[model samples]
Target: MTAAASSAGIRLRDHPAFILFWISRVCSALAFQMLGVVVGWLVYSLTGSAAALGLVGLAQFLPILCLTLLVGHVADTFDRRRIVLACQTLSALTVGALALAEGSGHAGLLPIYAAVVTIGASRAFEAPTMAALLPRLVPGEVLPRALAVASSAMQMATIAGPAVGGFAYIFGPAVPLTLAAVCYGVAAVAMAFIRHVHAPGPRSAMTLETLLSGLAFIRRSPVVLGSISLDLFAVLLGGVTALLPIYAGEILHVGTQGLGALRAAPAVGAVLMSIVLVRRPPTRQVGHVMFAAVAVFGLATVVFSLSSSFLLSLGALFVLGAADNVSVVIRSSLVQLSTPDEMRGRVSAVNSLFVGTSNQLGEFESGMVAALIGAVGAGVVGGVGTLMVVALWTRLFPALFHVDAMPVKVETRR
Candidate 1:
């Protein structure tokens, strides 16, 4: 498709590949969200230990940090569609096995942990490829809208998934696992029709020299570094996913239903923001907006921490989600537009690493802090830390504050 042809808002209904990818994403996201809740509950239920919950986050993230670089190389070198299909297929089968084990009453801690590790490994490959291929699906001008749509769909799935999963646990965790397997199966099938391909370029020499090249680019690219660092610190500190269960059960005095709402609240807010952004593009002063959103997220987290009422906590979480989506949309679009096509996979891999560290490692941080200082105290302190980081970052990265257009050229060494 010509770039001009794609500049027009291609109705999502008419785009078969996009529709397929969207449905697939929603299904898989729902299943993944459910799987997260089930695993957290299972681990905590089995051991009755906060440390066990932290271990769950560790097992999921450690693999991504270890294997993401290799996966990025593969993404740049191969057809992204095939890579996505293969990863989805393997993940589906893994989830299927989990479902089977659950049905037979054989689901144990070891098996569950093994399954999480396998899924994480598959994600290490899938995420980078998925991120890189997004541009090919739409024109550059329309990329933001497409991303917002995609993000909204995923958030809707997240909002629904955990709620359903939590309710299903009444019957057994098996029911939710079985449903998750179905979602994965459907996603694998939908992924089959994604025709976007990453044509190969001249083979870059494989060495530490080549791998370090991306980092060098990042160092010189203040815009990229600043955007990523903002996310890294803001999410790393303000993140409260690991502590939600404590608030749900203790402070809120609600059961699994409340936990489900807590899990879904952010996504609901994100979806709402995404819908609004589709009509209005983020044009100028995006860096300032991004900073403001991160600060809002921190403030919301603070409110959530102090709130004893379930409804008020949920409202705070919703605001956090909305602000978070704004930051995500801007930072993600900046990264994609600034980085050259040849380096998308590697850059995306690095991006994924930052995201994994912020989220998974953040989970561990929240869990450990909650264990030591209590959930409310830990969350409040984390929020304060995020605000501090934002203040310091703005002062340090002046170029980031001035960024307007995505840079066309980025020099990298082999």
Candidate 2:
């Protein structure tokens, strides 16, 4: 590690713990991406409606949202590693169950929904634990780079998963479900290899007051509050992932394969951006960059709404993904660096809530809007709404606008 980099914080490459953690995270991410494409295809095929797709998203996200506070509290007070292991085991079982159900040829809507709900419950526990554990695995200085790496891996997975899932669906829906089970099984094994990680600090006491402390912590931190809110609003209004099936089947005249391509498009852009971000970190005015990126994301969505050609729509979504990734990197780095170690899990739980909202709620918004106004019109309106949100956020979050990326200096463990 360079002396300058060391003085700034831990170098990501030099740390054994960080390397292992990164690898495990990447493997899990690839598995997750494959699972998503398969699940989406399964749901849509069964119901033949965009609203049904939104329901799928809702079932996955609702548990995460509802249990976030408890999840965060548990993360802060307990053994994070054990928490992760338990959740991973639960996740693997759910995936296996999904595979079994699909294979049986008797997989009803309720059964699928039940499996997803179990997966959702697992995530409610896992997300905060995983995010909080990253800092322990890596030195503070290279945290941003580490985050970039993890996000990039996820993007790559996104690129591969849907493409694979589409092909699997061609053979049989059961094929994709079984593949997802295998992926989750691999992820579970990979997680088991992590060792020697320390737990979070001891908790004072378990009480209703302690459970609510994470929320209280956010209320006092303007930077955290503003950044979280900015992400929530921008994504909620602008995201159109839920409506892709509608666009795919009706407007674009593309089949399941095309839908997979549509899903892969953003991840392609995100992966490309992640690679670039690795070499050239964002400048000091990250907040400004965030807003510009989000605005561009919105504008791209608007363009996508108007595009009749499949290629043109893909190009627009690519741009949107590119912009959104930049936003994600910046916001996530800021969130991680700004919070105290003890509070990282709770803060991350809060982040999960916002992100989950952006995803599932965005899906709901897109689905309803498409039902009411037509898919194309709904996307256009959502994009415009996103742009307005960016303008409002600029006015509201001066700190976020001016905050520069800092080298994460890990204070020596107590």
Using lDDT as the measure, the top candidate is: 1
The alpha-carbon root-mean-square deviation between model 1 and the true structure, to one decimal in Å, is 3.9
TM-score of each: 0.88, 0.88
- Residue range with the least summed lDDT across 10 consecutive positions in model 2: 1-10
Please give, for residues 316-358, the per-residue lDDT of candidate 2 as tens digits.
9999998988888888877777788778878889889888878
Clashes of each: 0, 3
lDDT of 2: 0.78
What's the residue-level lDDT of 133 in candidate 2? 84
Candidate 1 lDDT, tens digit per residue, 1-414? 112123436465446576676777788788888899889998888889877886787888888889877777777777877888888888889988988887898888899899999988888888777888777666677677667777887788777887788888888888888888888888888888777546754677777866766666677788888888889989999999989999999999899878877888898899889877666657678788888889999999999999999999999999999999999988888887777776778888889999988997788799889989999999999999988988998899877766665342332224
